[model samples]
Target chain A: EPEVTQTPSHQVTQMGQEVILRCVPISNHLYFYWYRQILGQKVEFLVSFYNNEISEKSEIFDDQFSVERPDGSNFTLKIRSTKLEDSAMYFCASRGDPSTNIREKLFFGSGTQLSVL
Target chain B: LAKTTQPISMDSYEGQEVNITCSHNNIATNDYITWYQQFPSQGPRFIIQGYKTKVTNEVASLFIPADRKSSTLSLPRVSLSDTAVYYCLVGGLIKAAGNKLTFGGGTRVLVKP
Candidate 1:
């Protein structure tokens, strides 16, 4: 199975600073997603993207959060200004186009540990 | 999206068969039950998925009753390496991109040798 790869296994940034997490999803997959798991908390969905636009987003995704598929191969999550509450493990996941699969499941990257001081 | 309820944790000894059951009382007709396993500090990995009846994979087996309101994930002859958090998710009808997937608090399985 093709894997989704995330760069910078760990990142630490000062509060109010900007950060970008990069991910390379499976080559043939068409949908992308971002999820975060705060320490000891359930993993929370942040957003989903497809067709160069956001398809759906959770309330946790605020104005400061943005996603981009720059140059087609890379999907990125950018936080304009990080906050202490932003500290968590951010995961990138993708699945192939649904038309080809009925029991669709996502393939996830290892994840990026983001720490905002 | 259907809401899932599962135990917070379970303990088992190596070589024992383990089953974690999840209940989604309001599950939709087209919803599918999927299970994922996540080791410490690693991303979730797919285990198995089933719409109804039983679906078995090399890693695990997903059993859904005829009503489709509940499902159980069975891991045969568990080992210490089988310790991980198991997540149950029920997805919408689209079964594809744009469908919302909400993960519930997972069942933490502790396999001791």
Candidate 2:
């Protein structure tokens, strides 16, 4: 089965540094999303992307965060000036058509573990 | 979004059947109940989803009563490898722009030998 793939399975960065996480969603998927889970916490939604623009974002997705569909197959999340609290597992997910008859399931990648020092 | 309540953890022996139930007292007409499983250090994986009644798939089965206030995820003949956290989510199926999913603390299941 086709799946979402994220690069840099693990990344360690210093505070105030910039980091970019890359993901390649399923080829036929039309919706993409970014979610993060802090250690021992529930998964939180960051942002959702469709048609090349952000559809919705959470308070956690503040000015420091941004997402882009740089190409037909690549979706990226960039965090400027990372902080210690930014350390968490970032996941990329995608879903197929939104028709009600079809099963709308979010397929997630293995996730990238980001460590900020 | 409806709030879900589930047990914090459960333990079962290998080859035993496991059932995880989630309570959502405020489920809406458009809402659907979906289940996801996550292993340590990995992302959540979709298991099954249903609006009402019982829906069965190869991996698992979902049972929703007439009231739809609660749902159950049944895993048959579980093994040690089935040890993981299972999440139950309630949301609408409409394709609205900027739609996002909210995940609550999942139930951690440990299957022993």
DockQ score for candidate 2:
0.70
Model 2 DockQ class:
medium
Q: What is the lDDT of residue B72 in candidate 2?
A: 97
Per-residue CA lDDT of model 2 for B1-106, tens digit only, reads 8999999999999999999999999999989899999998899999999999999999999999999999999999999999999999998865657367889999
TM-score of chain B of 2: 0.97
> Chain A TM-score for model 1, please?
0.96
Per-residue lDDT over A77-110 for candidate 1, one digit per residue giving the tens place of the 0 to 100 score: 9998899999999999998878754554889999
Q: How close to the true structure is residue A23 of candidate 2, measured as C-alpha lDDT?
A: 98
Report the alpha-carbon TM-score of model 1 versus the true structure.
0.97
Model 1 lDDT at residue B38: 89
User: For each candidate, what TM-score against the reference?
Assistant: 0.97, 0.97
Best by lDDT: 2
List each model's interface RMSD. 1.5, 1.5
* C-alpha lDDT of residue A103 in model 2: 56
The lDDT for every candidate, in the order shown, is 0.90, 0.93
lDDT of each residue in B31-78, candidate 1, tens digit only: 888899988888888888888899988988888999888999999999
